[model samples]
Target: MSKLIFVNLPVADLPRSIAFYEGVGATKNPQFSDDTAACMVVSETIHVMLLTHAKYRQFTAKAIADARTTSEVLICVSEDSRESVDARVSAAVSAGGTADPTPTQDFGFMYGRSYEDPDGHIWEVMWMDMAAANEAMACEGAGQAA
Candidate 1:
């Protein structure tokens, strides 16, 4: 069986976060959602668990870092095309997210953009040409292990 990843995030408002996630193209799985937590399905293999701050404390004693002040991590997802990458970030902004401090990248073969969710969690949307990337890497000796 393939391994699945469940990203657990602390949310200040469950319903608001749910709405934001849905706006950004995630599906809410009601079977795994409740008053204190929401299961946002990104893909078959990727699920994001949004837990209320109080409920999050049940899983960990450490205080949750204010993501706006301190970044714990950046969540990146890939899309089918460069246009899709921009569309996702644009949707995020319309859904109450802010653009990342970093600017969008356009390397011809790969394009990426980032946004910070309402809670200040970072998310990057990217698109890459795998075949072109592999060829470039080979030409640059990037894939060779000496």
Candidate 2:
């Protein structure tokens, strides 16, 4: 079976979070959703579980960090091209997310941007040309050896 990833996030407002995720291209999986939690599907192998603060507390004993004010986790996903990366960040901004919580990254072979969800969880979107990245890294390695 292909490995799947389920990212669980604590959200202050369930419905708002659901709408925000849907705006960013995720679809809610009703089969796994309820009043307190939502299952948002990003891809066949990637799912995000949006839980209310109460629902989230059931799973963790640590205090929930205010993502807006404190750094917790940086979730990253890859896109097909540099344009797609920018498009996703724009969509996120349109959906009420704050864009570029972190600085944008652009190398010849790679590009990246980030957005912060309503709850301040940062999500980074990136695209890369593997061949170019490998070639650059190889050159850097050779220079180091020399």
Candidate 3:
């Protein structure tokens, strides 16, 4: 069987977080959702559990760091193209996220941008052309150019 991943994150408001995720094109999995948490389906094998701060604390003894002041984690997702990256970042902004001031660009090999959600969680959207990367690596191997 294929492995599945569940990314659990703390949210100040469950309903607001659900709305924000919905605005950015994620669907809720009712079968795994309840009053304290909502399950957002990112893909067939990936699920994001948006848990209330109070409930989330029960899972860990360490104090929860305020995401606004300190980053707890950075969730990165890959897209098909740079345009798709920009579109997703734009969608995030429209859904109450703030884009990072600078975006990372590595000359056709890879590109990425970051956004801060209302609760201050950081998310990075990126695109990498493996074909281009392989070709560049081949050139490097021959000691010619990128």
**Top candidate by TM-score:** 2
The residue-by-residue lDDT of candidate 1 on 1-146, one tens digit each, is 87999999999988999999998999999999999999999999999999999999999999898988998898899999988987888888899989755688888889899998889899988999999988888877964665
- Write model 3 residue lDDT over 28-138, tens digit each, in one string: 999999999999998788888999988898999888789998868888988888998888889888988888734665577888888887898888888988998899889
Q: Model 1 lDDT vs. the true structure?
A: 0.90
Give lDDT: candidate 1, residue 115: 92
Off by over 4 Å in 2: none
TM-scores, in order shown? 0.93, 0.99, 0.90
Candidate models: Cα lDDT each: 0.90, 0.97, 0.86
Off by over 4 Å in 1: 142-146
Candidate 2 per-residue lDDT, tens place, 1-146, comes to 99999999999999999999999999999999999999999999999999999999999999999999999999999999999999999999999999999999999899999999999999999999999999999999999999
What's the CA error at residue 114 for candidate 3, in Å? 1.5
Clashing pairs in 1: none
Residue 134 deviation, candidate 1, in Å? Answer: 1.1
Q: Provide the lowest-lDDT 10-residue window in model 2.
A: 104-113
